[model samples]
Target: MTNISNAKIAILATNGFEKSELFEPRKQLMEAGAKVTIISLESGSIKSWDQKDWGESIGVDMIVDNASESDFDALVLPGGQMNPDILRAEDKAVDFVKAFFDAGKPIAAICHAPWLLIEADLVQDRNVTGYKSIKTDLINAGARFEDSEVVVDNGLITSRHPGDLDAFSAKIIEEVKEGIHKRMQKAA
Candidate 1:
């Protein structure tokens, strides 16, 4: 079983988020005993984009302006064409992502979601993976792009597409647990 019970994760997304990317990871993380919070641009609910139709509605636990990096243990960015596209346009959301990286916390970004990482300038000199189309942009931003189901560099975890959910979620969970173990060892 997963052992991240004390881990608190922040999932950043907004309207147009890929349906499964947000839901699947949230479900798995919660099941693993991690406390997950959905942080978005606004309160209320955010919509999602399923394969060909509109998907589920996820509640926002807190707005970007009110969120603090100290409250969470990790960050998860879910991708959909419009989701990250819209989020990158918001200065607060962009800064939120930047803060998480600045804190040296584990981050998981999949699909087109890595756009925020690019916007936050956190992709520099790191190895990552994302949708095929954005691979060029990530490379240009100083990320060593790789074509893989899942790529974990340090504490940054990334995946190619929605099809890689299994690998992506697994890697994120492992990294989170590993991070906890490392932190505990340091404290010891």
Candidate 2:
């Protein structure tokens, strides 16, 4: 630790999120003494996609409509194929993501979660990494793609998969402690 005890992190997700992708980072961040809030598309708990089948559910702390980038020090986006796919379609969810990026707040997106970044046009010209399946989509959206455990561009953190959760969570903590970054206004 970087002493992120005062950092408040918002995890944005919805039904069908990858089980470990969401749980691992949240667990690690919480252990690191950061306040982590689970924000979702609805008020109730959201189910997870555990490996090949449906997994457990995690309670939602606040709906995307009620949460704001200003309320937290950073943002985390966990990916399952369906999670980001569904969230990217919701204007409120997408706007929530965009607001964090627009303010230069620390954001961590693992696996397919980068889809939300693409939808918000935040990945354009930014260095990023994600699950293999989304690499093409990221490149198509103008992100400088890399195949790695973690990639940190300014305050934007990205990783390949659940296996990289340790590095992913660590980056989020480190970035949150470093505070806001000065982001260039990438042309949309």
Candidate 3:
């Protein structure tokens, strides 16, 4: 396995992102030695949804239109009803997601965040799991939806809800480590 120190990971979300879903994983990834970048539709700050009320403000490292998929090791999408709903409408966000898929980079999406994956059309033929409500949407979009806490297919990893944060964070780190290892092997 490659050392995770300094590995770069990008998170895509906006207002109403599940506070824990975004912040918790971000904390874990950073603690594990990965640099986390929060990219959003706007370039200032994004609000989050805590359990009872709005949560912390996260700075926007880059605008979605300005971020290149080649600049990071993997992509993360934190789910909240409004977050993914808005993200799916942003062309840059969809394209960025497509870039990760086309480049074979790992992507971890949790809760309602998979809506962006469907918008990017990456769900077609991919096995995924998401918030229970979106299962039909995923199925209609050609994804093989599963009911699970965490589902990893190829480089795509997904989780069901905010409660799955533990599993979600662990899987993203593992994928990032594995991704770097595979890239190093190819370069060697």
lDDT of each: 0.89, 0.92, 0.88
lDDT of 2: 0.92
Report how far off residue 185 is in candidate 1 (Å). 23
Writing each residue's lDDT as its tens digit, candidate 2 over 101-120 gives 88889989999999999998
- The C-alpha stretches of model 1 lying farther than 4 A from their native spots are 180-188
**Candidate 2 displacement at residue 130 in angstroms:** 0.7
lDDT of 3 at 120: 87
Order of the predicted models by TM-score, top scorer first: 2, 1, 3
Residue-level lDDT of model 3, residues 1-188, one tens digit each, is 22478789999999999998999999889888899999999899999988778888989999988899899999999998889999999888899998887788999999999999899877777789999999999999998999999998888999999889888898888888778322211122
Off by over 4 Å in 2: none
Total backbone collisions for each predicted model: 0, 0, 0
Best by lDDT: 2
Q: TM-score, each model?
A: 0.93, 0.97, 0.92
Q: How far off is residue 38 in model 3, in Å?
A: 0.6
For model 1, which pairs clash?
Answer: none
